[model samples]
Target: MNAPLTSDASPRLEDFPYRISDNVRFADLDPNQHVNNAVYATYFETGRVTLVKDRSHGLMPEGLSWMLVRLDMHFRSELRWPGTIEMGLGLVKFGRTSVTLDQVVFSEDKCVASAQAVTVLIEEATRKPTRLTSEIVRNFQPWRRRGVNVASPKF
Candidate 1:
């Protein structure tokens, strides 16, 4: 199996697409003094958006927009209030018409949660599913899953 891509051409974890460091805010904690479940989702989202924005993938592509098709999460541990957390994101699969985003939330040395999401590309004007362009695929290909080439069309 090919290693996960660190770039469009290389497949290695050392080429990790993006990493973000963030602190748990007072508002992020619930009465139990632990991070809220919804807040975990928000943190994962922030990590993903921050990476794409800094790396040149706008929140919405020109002539195309991505719609969320699915989201899955797993909580491994509880993040107590008062510590900084790191959020890591990677492009796990870049399919023809969709991309899967994988995110992990870490509280210092501990992994608090992990998540995955699938988003479908659609024509901006008509909101219809469209084939993912080569440029788009190329942008993600470097990081494609080792045994999976996600460039297949999906309606």
Candidate 2:
């Protein structure tokens, strides 16, 4: 229920209403023993799935599904095993056919990584962008906000 995160919005943990906690499994570790860099994407995917499940209750609009277009992530710190990863998600921007989601993964309140993803709603057959309908907007009101310009990735 917080205001949308504009281009200038500096979001805090309190600003996000959706949070999912996942354990750092042994399978997710790399040779260094810390969580693998690539595994963070899957962690962010967990947050997105949980958000959609909770918000839409699995009632996604017919012939519509989200497709990932871009992802930008920053590794702030390393995560260890036998710990919980607190992943937070918020709808930072809403576009005609896409939404930008901002997420952060924390280890016991210490942020370890963060990501910004652009997910687009496309027609299942034609793969064309679909407009955001009233129903679509209504279902996502819990995390609804105006779309803003995305910052270029540092990757």
List RMSD in Å for every model shown: 6.7, 7.4
Per-residue CA lDDT of candidate 1, range 9-49, in tens?
A: 32232333566788888899888888888898889778766
Write out the backbone clash pairs for model 1. Answer: 8-142, 95-150
Q: Estimate the overall C-alpha local distance difference test score of candidate 2.
A: 0.74
Q: lDDT of each model, Cα atoms only?
A: 0.69, 0.74
Off by over 4 Å in 2: 1-11, 53-59, 144-155
Put down candidate 2 lDDT per residue, 1-155, tens digits, no spaces: 96553332343565556787789999999999999999999999998877764534542477777888998887888898989878878777677887788888888677788888888888888988887665765556566433433332221
Which ten-residue region of model 2 has the weakest summed lDDT? 146-155
In model 2, the clashing pairs are: 94-147
